[model samples]
Target: MLILAPMEGLLDHGLRTALTRVDGVDRCVSEFIRITDQLLPLRSFTRIVPELLRGSRTPSGVPVRPQLLGSDPACLADNAARLAELQPAGIDLNFGCPAKTVNRHRGGVVLMDEPELMQAIVAAVRRAVPAHIAVSAKMRLGIDDERRALECAQALEAGGASELAVHARTKAQGYRPPAYWESIATVRQGVRLPVIANGDIWTVEDALRCRAVTGCSALMLGRGLVRRPALARAIRWHDAGRPMADADVDPCVAALPWPQVLPLLAEFWQDVCGRVERRHRAGRLKQWLNHLRHAYPEAQQAFDALRASNEPEAIAAWLLQHQELAALAARAPEVEMTA
Candidate 1:
């Protein structure tokens, strides 16, 4: 199974609506909602994941489970119990975040040092939510050591996590290269629940090696999916022994000449413009375009063209009006959703 990782500041409701139209992404986790002290009002959850009102599914019908990030076990449970009233598809606890600020606040990966405490939090959340609601967690191997990776995974499982997605890196590594897939195998051995391997899986080959090493039935995609939008589909196609490139494949991922990625970027910009304030629209657009360049090399220049503009309309107009872009859009094949 393919799962979209909960990427902060990137995969908001709008972008998720667009990306879910693509096949192979089974479900997505909502960007973590910071629960500092009290239970946020209904408006807060709605603002973070508007799709909750729409059956907790993105526009294209993929499920989006809300992820809660906080350190207070009782407070998290209190908020999670309240969130349960909204009937989210699932509740995901966040213990994998590596941000310095989050750690200083005693919230994310810092809790890795206390396996029992991590288990206590998961148990609290599980007890608060109804049994029908699936409760899960996302975590790194450990703060600075892999020695407790197995212990932590087992703790979460014992604490009632139905599933665990391990980022395969120590908190200290902080998203460095060479994800420890071998450690994932060790983790898998200790946990009875399904374990999803996550970290640095950028291609079909990388995924194959991950599954082989960890023997995990599932893999989570983050920046890699942004780089190669069709990485999930490609992996599925590879698994089914189907040809990689058929007619109507994602042009950006296929490495086609003059692949039309600008439309996707334009769609992203339009969504952000609608949901975000005018002041923040341009920055979000630029950030997304910059990331897309990792997979579509041509995006660098496109992003460069907009370095000076902060107005949403002007930035969107630039892509829609440029002669080369206009030509590409004219020739671009209409998007056909793959079943």
Candidate 2:
């Protein structure tokens, strides 16, 4: 199955709606919920993975694995047990997030440097969740060195992880420089569980090349899919030797303009309402616009226009006047749903 990597601020409902129709994404993992203390309420778990509470699936019917992030083995296991009640497609342990807040908390990639701790956390979580629900993990090569990749993979597998997804950069790399696909090959050789390669797969060629180099059977897409929603489908079509048509996203995304972007922004904000603060809501919207700008140049203009207007109407009016590109809205209103 093609997996959509859980991006903290990028793969919210609206974004997921858009990417779900792209064709090959069989599943998505919700953004990680950091478990810092024991007795984390059931409501907190549902808030991070609201879809799981609703039905253990994405709006498009794609299975969503709820990912847990933490430093304490017992706390992680406690939360995993509560999440298991939701019957998610699986439980995913996150050891790959490179965020400073997470690392400073001794969660995420910081755990990679402590293999024994990592093993204890995974083993506890595996024992807590039901045997039927798959237990998986996503990780970086190591804290900063290549030697830690295989060792970390072995540790997780020994602890009963059903599968592993390795992002090809280390904690220190933090999305910069090149992703070390060769290191993923090393991790694959060190483990018996299925290995999924992630990082730098922006296009079909990149996917093909990564598979050839790592011999990994599956893939996890992150930034690449955000930049181009149809990418997953394109990769699949390319692999099958099938001709595919491109969505003229430039025109379509531009038609809504910056003004029009507000309501859509509001839609996603509301989806996570009561779960996140207003400041966080607004920040998440801006973060998406930052990435959306890559696909539509007009997005830059719209982004600039909406810089101050957090209100929906103000943002919408700004878009109407600035959007001079072909009115893609007139031709397609449904793409927003798929996007």
Tens digits of per-residue lDDT for model 1, 1-339: 899999987888777876676678998999998888898887888789888899888887888999999988899999999888888989999999999988899888888888899899999999999999999999998998888888888899989999999998998898889899999989888878999999999888889899999999799998887777777877887888777565555533774332445556667777887778899888987877777777665767777888888987788778677646557566666533321
Per-residue alpha-carbon lDDT of candidate 2 for residues 167-273, written as tens digits (9 for 90 to 100): 99998888986999998998898788999999998766788899999999699988877765666776776677765344443322322234444444445545544
Best lDDT among the predictions, by candidate number:
1
List the candidates' TM-scores in order: 0.91, 0.83
**Model 1: residues with Cα > 4 Å off, grouped in runs:** 245-252, 255-260, 322-339
For the record, the alpha-carbon RMSD of candidate 1 to the native fold, in angstroms, is: 4.3
Off by over 4 Å in 2: 244-283, 304-308, 317-339
lDDT of 2: 0.77
**65: Cα error in model 2, Å:** 0.6
- Give Cα-based local distance difference scores for all models: 0.84, 0.77
Cα shift from native, residue 180, model 2 (Å): 0.6
| Cα misplacement distance, residue 69 of candidate 2 (Å) | 1.2
